[model samples]
Target: MVKELDEKIGALPDHVGWRLWRASRAWQAEFSAAMRAAGHAWFSEARAGLLGHIPRNGTRQSALIERSATSKQAVQQLLDGLEAEGVLERFPDPRDGRGKLVRYTRKGLDALRDGDRIKLEIERDYIDRIGRERFAALMDALRSLDAGPADASEEASVPE
Candidate 1:
């Protein structure tokens, strides 16, 4: 078992993972609030997160499942909910007759304009909260982490 972290630090024993999780939740919360204010009444953090993974032109449902790095059931449920809410719809994939393509509905496309506006507003607010350089560095760091898929056996090359 890992030893308890030094109490003075005021963080969990697995500080790095905890910090990342905390930060992600905070950012998602802020985004969700902004989305709700932008008149997307069907918006939830999970729905919004899945929506972010989708491309404007749309993609195969299987591709979305892969891109979101989540279970098929979870992705399907989210898609169904969004479809019921009229935010998105599913269509037959042209190239792959066996697969389905998911895309935003016309109403969804209209709301996407508001979503785009809200994203910039939220990004600007984040930049104001944590300076432009720091925010840029944070995004760069995250992108670096996300750039490649890593196996569980490979430890992240976190340099000293």
Candidate 2:
């Protein structure tokens, strides 16, 4: 298994996708430690990521599904958990009678504020380890990578 893994990775030393995947895992581990230290023992990274996708005011279920790039069932499951925790509430959309809008409750907003603070602390630690310049460059690179082709007609250019 080790030889096979080495062979696969050695052949794609410049593969950004694989490297990003590894980085994401590492970051999540660090984030979890930070959250634990911050006294949020029940913190769920999945829940946090899903909630981060939601706007403060409210967003339609369909819009959330699109933004989260998650299956309807998966989103619904997360919503149910959050609602049970009093972190979120779902109500009928005022404009669209047929659709539902999901919004954060006061408790949820407070939790979000705390999360933001914790995230900043973690970021500072990361910046200290990586240096401000490298951290800034990493952030810029992440933003660029995140801004993929805006439309179907636009394609990402790949290096040969």
lDDT of each: 0.84, 0.83
**Model 2 pairs whose backbones collide:** none
For model 2, residues 34-146, the per-residue Cα lDDT tens digits are: 76576656568898779878987878988999999999999999999989888899999889899999998988887777778877887899999999999999988887667
Among all windows of 10 consecutive residues in model 1, the one with the lowest summed lDDT is: 151-160
Query: Least accurate stretch of 10 residues (summed lDDT) in model 2?
Result: 151-160
Superposed by TM-score, candidate 2 places the C-alpha of residue 151 at a distance from the truth, in angstroms, of: 11
Q: Write the per-residue lDDT of candidate 1 for residues 40-119, one digit (tens) a residue.
A: 88999888779978888888899999989999999999999999999899988888889999998887887788877877
How close is every model to the real structure, measured as TM-score? 0.73, 0.77
TM-score of 2: 0.77
Give Cα distance to truth, residue 66, candidate 1, Å.
2.6
Candidate closest to the true structure, highest TM-score: 2
lDDT of 1: 0.84
